[model samples]
Target: MRAVMNAILNVVLPVFGIMLAGYLVGRARILGEDSGRALNGFVYYVALPALFFGSMADVPLARIFNWPLILSFGGGLLVTFLFSIAVALVFFRGRFGEVSMHGLTAIFSNTGYMGVPLLQIAFGQQGVLAAVITTVITAVVVIGIGVILLETDRHQGSAPRVIARNVSLGLAKNPLILSALAGILYSWSGLPLPQPVATFMELTGNAAAPAALFAIGLFMVGKSLTEGMREVVWISSLKLLVAPLVTAWLAYSVLGMQGVDAKAAIIQAALPTGALMFVLAQQYGVYVQRATSVILVSTVLSVLTLSALFVLLGVQ
Candidate 1:
């Protein structure tokens, strides 16, 4: 019980506080509506990529190449993706675009921004390394496969050029994937980063998580939560509970993952849906409100869910 309490206070509270602060700032008009977008861009384009590169650069290729661990994590994520689609088909019925929006929200997680920091705090540097690999997977699947599913119009005629262009652009600009690839190349080349450059990246990388949480808080402050409660709860459950359980089962049984690898896979699987879902919905003119609500609610609830996971996995 004491350990649980400590986890709540030390781990959960700080994250919630950062998000809460972001909410307050937005509500108070300390920053305009666009502030959230600005902060999100900064985190995505700058801080998160740096953190991923810095963390992965130092890790050996072997640690990042755990087939069982990757399988468990990827399988859990894909299962949740399919589950979200199934749920959307049933509940959403004719609302195909909204269904796609929810599917994206329910499946992908902020593994780079939030996952890296939370794992590091809970389990240390080794955990952060594991999370970097998860981040790479996320960047690939969510932007690649996930987007393809969401954009495919069964009714409208397919534009192969548009699809190809989008996929190509996604690959080119995906910072997390690029960082992982860069790390791998660097390792293969047996090149070491200069001390000053590495130190600079290290400092900035360490600040990414807390800043992201705070930005979340500020971003959500003024938004009315009344519009999307039903979809929000259902998707949040799928993300926090169903995904993790499926991933845990697969990690232990099918994949035969154990020890730290098993724990890390479960942890990544349970992360809240990524905020990128909302950005995507906004871009494509889908159920933007529904996606926004899911991101907000799931992130908040993940505190309890993640703490429970720590206890169950005996992280302490």
Candidate 2:
């Protein structure tokens, strides 16, 4: 009992404590209203790209070759995404693009912001491969599909050729995806990044978590909670409950994963929705309010659930 409480306090405190500081800063009006935009821009264009590149660049090619782990992680996310899409399409009866956004909120774990740190605390360096594998999967596959779907919908009625060209450009230009690709290529090539260059990336990447949380807090100020409570509840439930369960099953039964690898995958799956989803919501202008609610609610609930999971992992 004490261990679980410590786990919850230790893990959840630092992450959300920064967020709480950000929230207070927002409430205090220190940076003014548009500061959120500046912060978001930093994270989106600068911090996140640096973070992805540095992390992927350092990963061993051998780690990249772990087919079972990669497949299992990607499979878990894919199943959750498909399930979320199905639920949205059936019940919400929305346009396919909008439905895809809904599904994205349910499936996109806050792995970069929350999961990596949690894994580090629990599993040490063993967690690195699992975290990087899932982050790569999340960066490449999850966000990639969401961008394609939403971009196609956004450019509706354009010439087919124009839409195709635009979507190609959009994916190529997305900083998150492009940076991850560059890092993977660099790692594969086994090239050495210069010391100064590597240090710059390390510093920039380090700023991502705190800056993101602060920006989220600033962004949340004055946002109404009343508009999308029902949608928020459903998506949060899907993210917090269903996604992890599905991930655990896939890792165990399908991938034959056991011990720390299995736990790493499951805990990551259980993280709250990524703040990057909010950036996407802003970019695409789909489900913005509901996405906000999902992030707020899911982050809060993850404390209890994650604490329990930590205790469970410790016992095992």
Best-matching candidate per lDDT: 2
Off by over 4 Å in 2: 1-4, 311-316
Which lDDT value does model 2 have at 183?
88
Task: Provide the RMSD of all predictions against the true structure, rounded to 1 decimal.
Answer: 3.7, 2.2
> TM-scores, in order shown?
0.79, 0.90
Q: What is the lDDT of candidate 1?
A: 0.72
- Expressed as tens digits, the lDDT of each residue in 1-316 for candidate 2 is 5644565566566766776788789999988778877887888899888988888888877787667666666777788888878877777767767788888898888877667766676678888667877877786678778889888888878999999998898888989888888988999998888788799899998898788777777767777866868778888888887888887788888888887788887887888887778777766777766777788788889887777767666732
- Predicted candidate 1 versus true structure: per-residue lDDT over 1-316, tens digit per residue: 4654464456555656767777777778888777766766666667666766776677667766878878999898888878888977987664666777677777787676667766776678878778877876776556666455545543235478776666566656666567656766776666788898788778877666766555656646656776868878998999899888999999998887778778988988888877666555554556766776787788779878888888899877
Best by TM-score: 2
* Model 1 residue pairs with clashes: 18-214, 19-217, 22-217, 22-218, 23-217, 23-218, 23-221
Single out the weakest 10-residue window by summed lDDT for candidate 1: 149-158
Every candidate's lDDT: 0.72, 0.79
Off by over 4 Å in 1: 93-100, 110-129, 139-158, 173-180, 274-288, 310-316
In model 2, the worst 10-residue window by lDDT is 3-12
